[model samples]
Target: MENTMTKSILKNKCLIIDGTRAFMMVWLGQMISFIGSGLTSFALGVWVFQKTGDITQYALISMFFILPGVLLGPLAGTLVDRWDRRTTMFISDLGTGLSTLSIAVVYLLGGLQVWYIYVAVFLSGAFGSLRMPSMQAAMTMMIPKKSLGRTSGLMEIVQIGQFLIAPIVAGGLMESIGLAGIVMIDFSTFLIAISILLFIHIPRATVTAEGCAGQGTVLQEAVYGWKYIKARPGLAALMVLFAFTNFTTEMTVVLFTPLILSFASTAKLGLAMSLCSSGFLVGGLLMSIWGGPKRRVPLMMILMILLGVFSTMIGLRASVGLIVVSGFLATLTVPIISSSNQVIWQKKVAVDVQGRVFAIRRTITLATPLVTYAIAGPLSDLVFEPLMTVNGALAGSFGQVLGMGPGRGIGLLFVCMGLLTTLVTAIGCLSPRLRKVEEELPDAVITQSAQVKIEKKLPSLLPARSPRNKIVYAKCHDLKPPLPELLSRD
Candidate 1:
């Protein structure tokens, strides 16, 4: 009995040691790069708000992140599936570096306009649209399922670490080197990421048995993602649900910044943003240690409830401390949501096809942020601002608390938005489908588990199979294709 216990402890330690290398290979470079990127992003956001002092201009920064992703997702997803994933990631890092260098040059040249910054941000989004999905897809291929929860939790910690530090760093850096220094930091980190990535080799992915997923025309491959998602009821539902959540969150944010700014200043904006990062940091830390509940859906629902409460709190009254605390609470649930979502994909999707499937998945998931960017500016600037004022529609009652003038009116609208988000969650939870996601969307078991679940049942498949089995075989990561498809494939 003692020997058995000792062996178990040693095995657990070995797993940790193995994971430490994986974390360095996968997570460390990303975390360092993200911190630098966060610094640049925060610096840009504050600079815009400080210079224009307009909420619309502030929201445009988000557009820079969203528009390109939505517009280019289809093609990007196809190409990502078609290319070598590690190379794709390296290229993405390099692309961002190039963009950063250009922005730095523009700053030095003193030709840095709102339009230039906007364009750079858009380009970064475009490149990022390619990079993020590839990285996500790679994780499933490389990491073991049992450890996925921990790995994703650690990655979130890294992300939150960046956010927690960025605002504080950006704020101080602004006083010292301005935008150029932030851009410079971003540029350097990308190089560091590229250097690390150069050493890791990811085997090229290709479909087998049924047909080559990569040999098709762009449109053919792109449509396949649509077909793939439609075939899986659970995956489609996750995408659509996340799209709504993303849209609402984006819209609320458009309203959120202005609401806070009215009650405070740009520096206060930095402080609030940093504090918001604290919620994510703390949440991530807890997740890395405790992990999540075995059932993911319930945990996600509870997190959504907290998000609604916090959103409403920020809008109801604009105390700086209250706003910062509320923002912190709003992000606190992120690690749970994100890590679980990653586990879902890693388990359900095949590593080979994950590149395309996840790409399309990410593309659609990104739509809300784009929609928010598109509409938030107009709605807050024009409609809500007008309706909630002293002499406007709700002036008699709401105007007393929200006030007659500019910022508070917008704040009131944001409060209403928070309620709407909460209502949506209530409705979503009541859905039989989302509630039963586990039963319906069972994890997409890998064809051959490298360990205990290794396939003892390697069923034989002829070159041309029964059509349905043929397609299934083609999609399997375990099925190595006939030579020509594997060799002439890329």
Candidate 2:
């Protein structure tokens, strides 16, 4: 009996470790594909700006990238839950690749038009939306509960690598091999990602009462994610805060390229962007090593406030050096903020319902950015740009302080965005519900011991549903009432 028990424990440990291995495998393929897509994206941004010489048209690309994701997120999330996550990711990658290939073909044959690029971007975004929730849900299945923060940080590294490397390389490649070659490379990356998915297996989430409650017709299931969030005031408030921050971030993103290109050459723009984006890599590495602080809310809020301060610095001067330094500082806070927030949701929400819940969370937060992208260009070109010119209205006051010129108006806008972001973050920090959310919410993640017990057929030791119909998993860290006392109550 002793030997049998030991064997059971060993088997469970192997299964848990295998899940981590699977996660790394999937992550590798995605990382490669991310770099490839970044190349195409950077090349296209340069191409569009050069072609039209219009910030409004350049901003349209970002708007299209976000619009479909915000619009279709709920439906995509429901579908992710209903379907196999691995398969959904597979299809999503394939569809996005096809869209990219279409752009390459159009460019080669009939000569690519601006409208063609927009159509391709729209189709790509529509397909890419399905990948986000599915990937997050898959991560929950593959990663241990305690390691979610580190893993999220690791994921950020992929994003950082894409941004840090792609711009510098794409700028050079565009002059040599050209955009067509870049697009084909991106399509090949999709194939590599799908091939990896074909080999690896992602575990299905265990059905809980929360997951069951969310099960219904398509429309009903889609709406249930919103209801789930509404019931948790902390999560709802967190999402609202994210929406506001995302708005400010998008406003900056739409303007950054134009801001740099205004007073500098394309080569300098690439160099400045590459230098700034390196901060993302550094932050990701730090988070991966340290796994963030224990009190995540305070850390997140503090970083957000710092992010605002950095944004203000970006537009204080027209120098590339200033923009590089400020941009780097601003991006440094992003991965830390994102990883902490992601870990909170991972810990609090049940795995089975994560797809729908994460989907809705994404939709709400991203909705703000859609509006930001749509209006940022016109606002910069028409309103802000005109106000800070040499003979413009605000030239005597605000322009004197910020310096009057082509990009100075946009610089003034950045100062306003930075101030607003800081103010909003400060207000969010004061919310007791948001601040003390960790104390209020019980951990929904299943423990390794719980998994072991379930596999060993110790039904009596398994978790039970709480009065609130929540699964009361035995978290090893909840020591106040003692593990046995908590389990007994459940």
Candidate 3:
């Protein structure tokens, strides 16, 4: 009786929802999960930092969180393409939720170690790899092309909860219900996200010439994402630009907490983080409504330059106010830039091939961050921290302006990295291929119909010249009804 009523309710709800409304259902669930996860993340970071007080060890948590996902991206993407996207997401959420539960169990048993958290984070990341590509590929089917920008913007609101609200709440909760309680909340959010998946419908991607060409053994299909991008110079160049920018971004992210903690209390750290990150919320809201400019490439470049400027400001002084204002402005640009970039990929890549292509893109861009996370700790601790000390070598020279203190070395490093980011963006703007990508690349045809209709007509529509190489005309254009039906007499 319960099962039947649940199904009835789902069917009744789904009946009124169009593609956009369906996406909203999914988005709301993800937003809740983000907030829940954010609370745990904030608590964990504080716990680890207070327990160890070593920057290198603190940095390892992030590395472990990211490395497994980056390494598994290609394989995960292939599976996402082969599986029902909703099912794939369901499994991903379950796996991550279990990982969270394991940490809680360990803590309850009084056997929880930092290393245990690392292992759990690694497992969570492996599961998360599937969730990322699955969500991206599913979006194309659930949203109209015109609304893609707004959808991306709306998605950034999840980050607002994760980055802004989570830190503040987590800080207060840490003194009350504690980390185990926080982890339990995260697990509950995952269940809620999984439940939402059962009530929504995502249309399967219709196979096209591009998708057919990509078909083969598992290895062949995984490699296909790379081949598709290489054939498109514009996308390749854009990937390179993102690779460098993401590197700087990660370096800043890894260092931001430690930098603040070096000179202030954990309470202050949480406040600065939450307040500065409000920029993401402001930016997300703006993008949700504005949907960005038509000429997205130029807008992305301009935002990148501004991001570099704000990043530099983050380390200018150890003052909380400076970091808060600068950090706010910096984060404000993130959603707009990310939304613009995502819209470009959605428009350029065929729907069926997006899983593989987006995975490959994420793998390449994310690989750079592994280097940043690995070196961010040792470099800051061994090199930058030493050089910025009051009586150190740099105190007589470079330290004169930036000041010589505990976190000053990181501040100087932030200045240099931010300047480099600006320089890199400026150089990237000179690449003609990247600047003219919109003009050179054709917007892919995305049909918003049930998969059965297109798949049923696919066999008769194939071209003969090269079965996989030639474009299927009917798939690219609207399919007309059969002539027999039009000519029949009653």
Each model's C-alpha lDDT? 0.69, 0.82, 0.82
Which residue pairs does candidate 3 place in steric collision?
Answer: none
TM-score of each: 0.81, 0.86, 0.87
lDDT, residue 465, candidate 3:
23
lDDT of 2 at 349: 87
TM-score for candidate 1, please give it. Answer: 0.81
- Model 2 TM-score is 0.86
lDDT of 1 by residue, 323-394 (tens): 778878887876877787767766766455676677777778777676677777677778877877667887
Order of models, best TM-score first: 3, 2, 1
lDDT of 1 at 193: 84
Model 2, residue 316: C-alpha shift (Å): 1.9
RMSD of each: 8.8, 6.9, 6.1
- Mark the regions of model 3 whose C-alpha exceeds 4 Å error after superposition: 1-18, 47-55, 262-265, 389-397, 449-490
Query: Which model is ahead, 1 or 3, in terms of lDDT?
Result: 3
